[model samples]
Target: MMKEEVLSVLVSNHFGVLTRVTNLFGRRGFNIKALSVGETENPAFSRITIITEGDEQTLNQIQKQLSKLEDVKKAVIIPDDLLISRELLLIKVSADAENRPQLDALISEYSAKIASQQSDCLTLELTAAPEVLNLFIEKMRSYGIMEMCRTGSAALALGTQTVYHDAK
Candidate 1:
């Protein structure tokens, strides 16, 4: 059965590294649902978070290919059973005097914070699992969403273990 996977890859922060990694996915015809890349706390490397959906064999192949890239220092596919994953979403919804109170109540019920407020719109920030975020988005659709942005899933393994290919 196909399942979603979140992978954390460490690579050299160099020109074309991002292109190379993305090209690998494109060449394999894998659909990337979301991707976030940023410099790590260490200056020498960068972290890339990729969310993709595929069966076990396809995911394994993608991991093997990613590991072969020269710029990649480590590529770890976080198994569903061992990972704690969450994403942050910022949503701007249309609101006026009529619906403001109802929207505020919905936001509170979802445990979302109002990041900004204007005369006609409200911006809410929510952090939760992807499924929860999707549900929240659906709920906001009735009120008319002006804009929305989501941070791709960021994940860490549970317990004391860390997935480091170099240490393996």
Candidate 2:
């Protein structure tokens, strides 16, 4: 059975590397649910956090293939329960003077903030674990979410272990 999986891949920050990795998944008919890539502490390398759903066998195959690639240093599944992860969401919701108080309450309850306000709508910015962010969006649905955008999760292993790469 396919289940949620998060892979932390350490790779050389070189051109066409991302395409190669994504092509591997495409060839196997796998869809990446979320992917976030950014520079690591060492500017020469980048960490790619990919979230997808696949069975153990498929995950193993992908990991093995990734490790064998030219610029890929290593690929390992970061256990969902054993990692620190965060996602960011920006949402613009319908609001007015009468609804401001209730919106304020939501902001307080979820530790979010009113990023901007317009004549009849307001925008909010929230960053948190997936579950908490989902809940906040659900609650805000009642007020009509006008626009929204979310970034793929950024995650790291829970302990001191870090994904290492060959930086030459």
Candidate 3:
């Protein structure tokens, strides 16, 4: 059975580190559904959160491969129930006097912000769970989406868990 898994990877913050880390997944024939990477509190380290779908054994293999990389400090799977994840969605939807009021209702319903507005369209900014963002996109389709850009999932374990507990 295929299952979605989120992996938190701690690595050295330097050029080409992301490429090398992602290459491990490519070599194992695993597709990354979502990936977010950024420097950690410590400037020399980075945290990479990856979302992928695979059966148990394959996922385990990918984790092991990630740990073996020169730049990888640690790689661990984060359980869904214990994870807190969010993504940013920026969408430009068609709007005019006829539909502006309806679009305003949707924006209020979802707590989305009007990032910008033009005579013909409204650009909205929403940061929410991936599923919520997906639903919002579906809702906007009827209104006509001019363009959209969404970031990959950025996540961390809830409560006391820390991905970089031992980083120096």
Candidate 4:
């Protein structure tokens, strides 16, 4: 059975680390569904949230390989059994006076927030599971979608603990 995994990696904020990490996945032939990388609050570090789809054994191997990289401080595979995952999507829909109200109602049904509005378009921001976001995108197609952006899944382990592990 195909499964999806979210990996949160903490690495030194250095050039080429992203490429190296991505190359590792590429070498393994795992398709990355979504990837988000940003500097952490700490100036010296960055966090990478990667979503990939593969079988369980392949996912495990990818995690192990990522953890072994020199720049990688820690790599944790968020298990399906113990994490809450979500992605943020910004969708700009083409709208006109005639269909504006209808689009507004559809956005409300999805509980999307209006991030911006212009005479020709309305940008809606939604935070939900990937499936929900995909559903919204599909529905908006009929209304004419101008553009969209999605933040790859960011997940946290459920409970009071964090995923960081220090290596001496």
State each candidate's clash count: 0, 0, 0, 0
Candidate maximizing TM-score: 3
Tell me the spans in candidate 4 whose CA falls farther than 4 Å from its real position: 166-168
The list of candidate 1 runs beyond 4 A from truth reads 165-168
Predicted candidate 3 versus true structure: per-residue lDDT over 1-168, tens digit per residue? 899988989999999999998888887798799999988898989989899999999899988889888899988898988988899999999999999988999999999999999999999999999989999999999999999998888888899868767633
Write the residue-wise lDDT of candidate 1 on 35-133 in tens digits.
Answer: 988887778788888998899899998888999999998889887888888899999999999998889888888899999999989999999988899
Considering only N, C-alpha and C atoms within 3 Å, which residue pairs clash in candidate 4? none
Lowest-sum lDDT 10-residue window in model 3: 159-168
* Model 4 lDDT tens row, 23-131: 9988878788899888887788888989888887888888889889999988888777887888999999988999988888988999999999999999999999888
Structural similarity to truth (TM-score) of each candidate: 0.92, 0.92, 0.95, 0.90
Weakest lDDT window of 10 consecutive positions for candidate 2: 159-168
RMSD of 3: 1.4
Name the regions of candidate 3 deviating beyond 4 angstroms. Answer: 166-168
Better of 1 and 4 by TM-score: 1
In candidate 1, the residue pairs with backbone N, CA or C atoms under 3 Å apart (3 or more residues apart, or in different chains) clash, namely none
Candidate 4 residue 8 Cα shift, in angstroms, is: 1.2
Q: By TM-score, how accurate is candidate 2?
A: 0.92
